[model samples]
Target: MPGLNVLAGDLLNVMRFYTRLPLPVFRFEREAHALPDFRRAAWAIPVTGAVVGACGALAGGLAYLAGLSPLIAAALALAMQVAITGAFHEDGLADSCDGLFGGASRERRLEIMKDSRIGTFGGAGLFFALLLRVLALAELFRLMGPAALVLLPGIAALSRAVALMPVLLLPPAGSQGLAASVPLPGLPAWLLATGIGAIIHAVACLWLDLPLGGLVSGGLALMLMPALAALARRKIGGHNGDILGGCQQVAEIALLLALSSAANWRGPL
Candidate 1:
């Protein structure tokens, strides 16, 4: 087995690719390893999400410029994320919604979440989620122009960063949910790093002249997880991997909607 230092280094190497940081790696080994911990990959989830979100925004913006319907572009961009991540969180979100609403017992809910097959509730939940995202992106693209294209990935990263709050504050409820499998991050370390990330995101927004869009709107978007975490803890007993992913999806959607609205009402800063 690789030493702890080597393992940590390897993990960081894999993670660097997901974040905005620039790091180089050897060519031969780049594609050799399968992502070992999909649960641990939560840290990287937002980074990958940001990439896909940016692509979607770009597709939307370009299509709008080319006279295509804004909705198509937004939908395609959303499709891109679904394609890239295989709708990983969306699946989690759907399963979670189904489990939350349809399952009668804790065990039954977990079982329903574990089933790979999509249920009626899950399907409907997914449709609404995607529809909301598509419509939201279309409106933003139509109104915000190129800035909308550039900010999607950043917004995604920020929202995922927000999802970190639960991992920092709450314990996993399930014995086998993905969050339970992921080693709990040291609260101080993760929160400190997250704070820095949040500051940087805010600074970027301000530097980009997003005005009230950054502080007020951005802050509101980021607030979803803590609120949801409080609700989940009260209702479900604790956080789980599905809950974490669900947090990410919800945060992203909320941030996008809030920012888009802010950008519309408040003129360029």
Candidate 2:
């Protein structure tokens, strides 16, 4: 009984770290077992990736079973995250775009992202990002058949993992928020986990016989995220929690597009 209790507590700690829920302290607290410090939170990236991905897979499956379009499935997946995390990331993506592109200086950019108010850039960015995702998902649905439901989660995990790459490599723009609490994980640890996660995602993609086109598109989407992060770092001078979230959202859309294309071109290779 004690052993089971300990395992449950550890799982809760992991859940709290990955999701938006605040666990009851006694139920899941362990200062030593808490997520790696903010600096090393990169280690938790893959874990978070898997959780979000699992959610996406579930939602995507339901969407398919309901005979809904791929776009609906994709949107449903997005909706699930918004429900779970309070749109924390979607908000970040919008804010980062508004501030970075709309402002003249790093300070201004950061200030813009911080404001709860939405600007033209932010609104437009959100619209386009959501649209891209919907369209990409629809395309993927048409191409991948039912296996897409399973593959979607793997892609989600990979996208989140991709977002962590930037966080691990760059300094935070602010000293607060969840990122502040996350610790920098060791390079060796991060690399090993990331490699394993990548292998799993890749194996899943290959199993689906996804087309080269989809793979390229999806891989490009993942690559674009870090590039955006690099740009955000340079333009805004550093990363914030919001920017990190934006990267995850963008990467997921890109992956869906790539995988969709691959499925159409090669029928899951």
Candidate 3:
């Protein structure tokens, strides 16, 4: 049962860190020293993401059942996700955009990212990101109807899994932030996390009988991870919490867009 306890603790830790849910309180003294163990529990990240996505899917499905338009249902679903995650990834995307575009140098970029205030670039990034997600989800709903329920959760899991790439590949940019403070997961942990994510997607595909369009969309999103990590490396020196967030946002949007276009090309899967 000790192994089960550890697994349970790790899953709770991921949920506590990533979401706004009111989970059961953990033992403070034990958990404070267990940071390294929790970090190594990167494999549970996709599980947390699945929970978040499920919440969004539930919200969207309910809205659709209540006679809301696809657009409105999609917006509510995205809003539900933002609420559940506390907009953590969205904040990261905004900060990364501000730093990457507004700052003149790498150091300056990092500085801009550190600032609590959002700037023009950050505002624009958030706007477009939210817009794209809403539109894409609406399109998916219009085309696939209820099938989006399963596909969205899988996409969410996959996006979070991809964010681990930056953490695995790049060193922390500084000594003070989240990336530095948290222990980086090694190859085994990464493999476990990604493996879980892939399994989730594969199962969903088979269960839903997803078409080529759905498969292609997921493939494209997966491919974006390494490229985004490479760009983050060149732009701001290395991966930080913000960079991870940015990766999640980009992956989510890319997946959604691909899904949207696929919906147009192929009839419901």
Q: Which stretches in model 2 have alpha-carbon errors above 4 Å?
A: 1-11, 21-28, 31-43, 211-222, 267-269
Give stretches of model 1 more than 4 Å off. Answer: 1-49, 196-200, 267-269
In the range 41-71, model 2's lDDT, one tens digit per residue, is: 4444555566766776688788878998777
Q: Give the higher-TM-score candidate: 1 or 3.
A: 3
Q: What is the per-residue lDDT of model 3 for residues 1-269, given as tens digits with 9 covering 90 to 100?
A: 24766777778878888888988765632573245453468878889888998999999999999999999999999999999999999999999999988988899999999998999999999999999999999988998786787777777888888777877778788787876787777778877887787677667655655556557766787788888788888888788889889889998898789767866776665
| lDDT of model number 2 | 0.68
Give the lDDT ranking, best first.
3, 2, 1
C-alpha root-mean-square deviation, candidate 1: 4.7
User: 211-268 in candidate 1: lDDT tens per residue?
Assistant: 6776765678667778878866765667887777787778777766777777678654
Give lDDT: candidate 2, residue 133.
75
What is the TM-score of each predicted model, taking all chains together? 0.79, 0.81, 0.93
- How many clashing residue pairs, candidate 1? 1
**Per-model RMSD to reference:** 4.7, 3.9, 2.2
TM-score of 3: 0.93
Q: Which window of ten consecutive residues has the lowest lDDT sum in model 2?
A: 36-45
* Candidate 1 overall lDDT versus native: 0.65
Ranking of all candidate structures by their TM-score, best first: 3, 2, 1
